[model samples]
Target: MNAPPAGLEIRPLTIPRTIDDPDAADFIAMTHVRNLVYAETSGHDDGRMAPAELLPNYAPDPAEIRYSWLVLLDGEPVGRVGVDVPQEAGSRVVFWLVELRRSVWGRGVGTAAYALVESTARAHGRTVLQTWAEHPPSPGDRLEPPTGFGSIPLDHIARFLQHRGHQLEQVERISALDLRDGLPRVRELCARATEAAVGYRAVQWRLPTPPEFVDGYAWMKSRMNTDAPAAGLEFDEEVWDAARVARADAKIVDAGRTALVTAAQHTETGELVAFNELVINNDLTEATSQYDTLVLSSHRGHKLGMLVKCVGLLAWLDIAPESPRVLTYNAEENRPMLDINEAIGFEPIGYEGAWKKVLSDPTTAGADTADSSDSSGS
Candidate 1:
């Protein structure tokens, strides 16, 4: 830790955090500050992702590797920021986590943490120093455009990103289909899609996704970058392998969340061409359906995307009838999938534009499996 230029000094935080340290006071106090500042400044509660009490092991054990430090100004713990470089992130770059404290909000505390975050990532032999901030969308890329979302509109940490030069990339819409309506017609459309692909066909496979197929599924996910737009994302495709695949499976098993999927696979080669995964929230708050649609250059003609979804919908309905709705996000430009979702009755719940900022400098940008694993949380 270098002495932060003159009036400010930044160094590693020495707050003890462990799952067993139930009396984690600094951890708890910091959570309140973070959540308050986050919600007040950003408009949504940030603490919902992980409670302050969870400072120790926000994630499960095997994946249980986390190192963070608190920032202080002249001795008062102003804010805290840390790095979470997962050894692996479901085939993605083990992520980089950077969080800040409130009182230190405008004091160059963030700039200081920014410096520390990069140093930390480099120390771990990681090349990327990624962090997510709610800045406005960048100038180009029709897929993404400016939407008035600053870190927290009324307030704005995201402004820091734009000022810094991060660019906006992908925006996700939360959509839902009232499954209470039954899917006789949706299934029929799926069956029709299956029938239409003469040489190509839709194959429905269930979990116990076969040890051999895990890598394939991870591969399919990594392809989100293909047509899927993201900001500052440098996709590393090699991260997904058999061992990592099994670790993912083991994580799910250990967490006890059931995986139900219906994906479109190549009939001749059995290569997984397109897919969707559905999760049943054990807490029963609501079931989640994550659908990622893809097509190989050779397999582009068939309605495999739609077919897989309909089949997956039926499967989810059958398995988790207790589910109230099915939800997903589609870029507004993606009319084709939108057409299918509409045909099956999924409608927009809310819209949010994904924003990125390179600032003058760029920071590319969670945890846990205690039962619930929302993408934002990790």
Candidate 2:
């Protein structure tokens, strides 16, 4: 897992067709490159992964069209790219991830890799190709003292993506909350939210959403697509139902992760109005992710978002007390959620740019005009 040696020739690397069947050596090399590139880009240590951890995520989801490649130089992996194409009807969206070793950055490797990803996605009848990029905020932006939100330096990836015509869609602030700092503020917020939500009660569950609440939960989840500020990115409202929710829950469980969800219920109507989720993988001692936190448009003013989030955090702490921090990303423009996050002691660590590019229009063959936009923290 040491760094690949220098003085290698630059060329397009052929992707292994059956990476899921990788030999022990190939698996080790791929994981090494993935972690190395991730660390270099984010300035953080990539958590150590056991063999089981790698095996579980090795195969692509059967329900979606997926493509991936390891960028190799002189027979050594130096980067990687992956594309995820969902199977929903009338949906032409494609999600992508591209990472390269710091040594090969600014050398046209990433640009070339993206060109391949773009063409492949277009060939697959995908209209929208999107990925997130980590970059520094503008100089004019202020960096809050406790957290370094706007202080990171701009890197080559941002410029490379721009050169390839990908527009910066949305700027997302990456924030972290240290659970060890105590949840006094969070508890206070929960109290205020509960008081404000006069006729609402909070509910908590671990994965496999209760059947009775499935319909209400689906309704709230669908609203997240439409109600959240998306800046200018073009994304269709995702269709959600009990089946999809169950499938998602199953996937999380299959990946050795536990989902702790807390929801707000209308005391009078017995309907769920808001919910938040936190995911903790098998490695409970590391970090947990704050997944979705949505408050329905009809139920926004009562601080339900804050309440569900607080409830979820407390629930997570009880279940996984070994966790040190919880991380979440919010669109810089999402002031309401950002305010709630800040009030709960979450501090910004960095920013992410949601970049999108429209490939050839599915309806128009050979159409070369590509549209680009950025929005939301995804």
Candidate 3:
């Protein structure tokens, strides 16, 4: 870090009244800062897809209080911080995200910004505040990514969090599937999966989930939380129903994104037994993100996960022919999902470390120890 710049400042930003509202001045400035920092650390520029631009897709729950801040140096934005207060009563955890330009990383900008964030959390009567940081692979770790793109160095954020009392909670593998390379293999696997998935068939729709399967889809969505492999992270079984599914579909549509869903239905009972989602932002030329892929335990033996994913990918190729890649993250310990991804030629690219710090009670809460942050960003 260079010599500390003078007069560092943290300014609050207002959330837009509606997604269509013109970008607020502060929000635009923060997005620029985030883009610069992201390019510096990740070696890629995604200015077009900055957080401010994607806010509508993830609008907070009605009862959740959200805050955004700009970290400025000499009156210029250099970093960003975002926080969300839990909406439910008896919940003490507050979720947050932070980023600082690499040039100003060690000069206390992140620390000062986090101080303000902590103050805000405490002011909300929240007891725990947690954020995530990605770490670069160690020297001994395998490297398969082509030159230039590689793991983000873990040292900087690791040291920063440890200095502030955060501890490692879980690690997830960032994996990618090269559509062009896997197209043939995907078809082969899909064929096998179809044969193995006898007595079951798939249903799919673009954005809004079909009305008839909303309830079954909701049930599977809730089961996704409880049935997956979650090793060390604290998580809660999410409450899902038709209403939440409808809202989620609306959010996806509002964001100008298309969701290609391929779900396996139990032909015998007409229930959605397994499902997977592939989301493509308006920019069909870039990589698509793969969201939740779940199969009820009772429906697990039929290879439905692979069947649904392959079908979804095939549909994506037809709809977004220009797409180059698909990205998905799975807990490092989730061998089953990883196995399916690997079978489909999804290669390892990087890793993300989930960190947590529990705040001690103010009357005695240390505000440093981490014990209450949920690992899955709940």
Minimal lDDT window, size 10, model 1: 366-375
Q: Go through the candidates in order and give each one's C-alpha lDDT.
A: 0.54, 0.70, 0.71
> Roughly what TM-score does model 2 have, to 2 decimal places?
0.82
* Ranking, lDDT, top scorer first: 3, 2, 1
Identify the leading candidate in terms of TM-score.
Answer: 3
70-113 per-residue lDDT for model 1 (tens digits): 55567555556666665545432334434454444454556655
Supply the TM-score for candidate 1.
0.64
**Candidates 1 and 2 compared by TM-score, better number:** 2
Candidate 3 lDDT, tens digit per residue, 1-378? 133347888778766755447756676676677667655654543224654336674466654677877777888787787787766557677778778776666565666666666777778787666666555455543322222222334365665666667656666787888877549999999999999999999889887888888888889888875898654444446677777887778777876777888899999989899889998777888778899999899878899999999999988898888878888888776788889999999998767766666777633424333221111111
As for model 1, its CA RMSD to the true structure in angstroms is 8.4
TM-score of 3: 0.85
- Deviation (Å) of 32 in candidate 3: 2.8
